[model samples]
Target: MEYRISEPFTKEKFAQLKAGDTVLLTGTVYTARDAAHKRMVEMLQEGGQLPFEIKNSVIYYVGPTPEKPGNPIGSAGPTTSYRMDAYAPVLLDLGETGMIGKGQRSQTVKEAVLRNGAVYFAAIGGAGALMAQRVESAEVIAFEDLGAEAVRKLSVKDFPVTVILDSKGGDLYSEGRAAYLESRE
Candidate 1:
């Protein structure tokens, strides 16, 4: 079933999501890709505060393209999730509850998600142009020197995604493939 969920999801809200569920996420979400994650992780290691509060936050793994005239953002899409695996656990442990990206995550990230009551959602690949439409506002929140890889704070409405991994350790990538294969019999 499709759910309309707002950002800053609590543990109770996260408990309601499972792998393979469709979600239309609304409200603010932060964007960061490889470079930004590296910087943020490094900053944390040095005892610095993050640009935004990590608690109850949802972060999208994306590096949007340059915007055209009058648009809040450009083609915004999910980047491969594994690239952020090294940093995700730290954020999850810090109380982040949701993620939006594409591709499979490492076992460590999956474990972190389960342990921290977090969820991972996969946005459609190659749907950048369409996805950008959902972003109502965008501003660089940190690391502006990184250009397109800079961290961005975005306000989104009905941003689409599918739950790929849930807090209970459910994984759609493996289970969905097996289910599809079984259906062929």
Candidate 2:
């Protein structure tokens, strides 16, 4: 089922979602790819405060292209999730509740999701132009030196995503692949 959800993802909000559910996420999302993630993790290791609040937040794994005139963002497609897997668990443990990315995650990230009552979301690949339309505003909040890979705070409206992994350990990728194999038999 398709669900329309906003930010400040509470326990109740997360509990209602499951793997394979469609989500139209509207609200504040922090943009971070592997570089930003690594920095955040390093900060955490050093007991430094994160640039933004991690608790009850969603992080989109994207490094957007240059914006055209008057647009909040450019082609903002999701990066491969595995690149951030190394740092995800640490952030999740620190209260990050949701993620938006593409491709499979490591077993560690999957375990962290369940352990932290978090959800992993997958945005469509090659749909960057369409995805940028949902972003109402975007600002660089941290890591500006990284250029396109810089961390951004984005205010989005009806940003599309799918629940690839859920708080209860359900995995859409695994289920979908298994179903596909079964159908071929």
Q: All candidates' lDDT scores?
A: 0.93, 0.92
lDDT of 1 by residue, 37-136 (tens): 9989999999999999999899999999999889999999999999999999999999999989999999999999999999999999999999999999
How well does each candidate superpose onto the true structure, as a TM-score?
A: 0.98, 0.96
TM-score of 2: 0.96
Q: How many backbone clashes does candidate 2 have?
A: 0
lDDT of 1 at 101: 96
Q: After aligning candidate 1 to the native by TM-score, how far in Å is the CA of 10 from where it should be? A: 1.6
Residues 96-162, candidate 2, lDDT per residue (tens digit)? Answer: 9999999999999999999989999999999999999899999999999999999999999999999
Worst 10 residues of 1 by lDDT: 5-14
Candidate 2, 1: how far from true, in Å?
1.1
Top TM-score prediction, candidate number: 1
Candidate 2 regions with alpha-carbon error over 4 angstroms = none
Which portions of model 1 show Cα errors greater than 4 Å? none
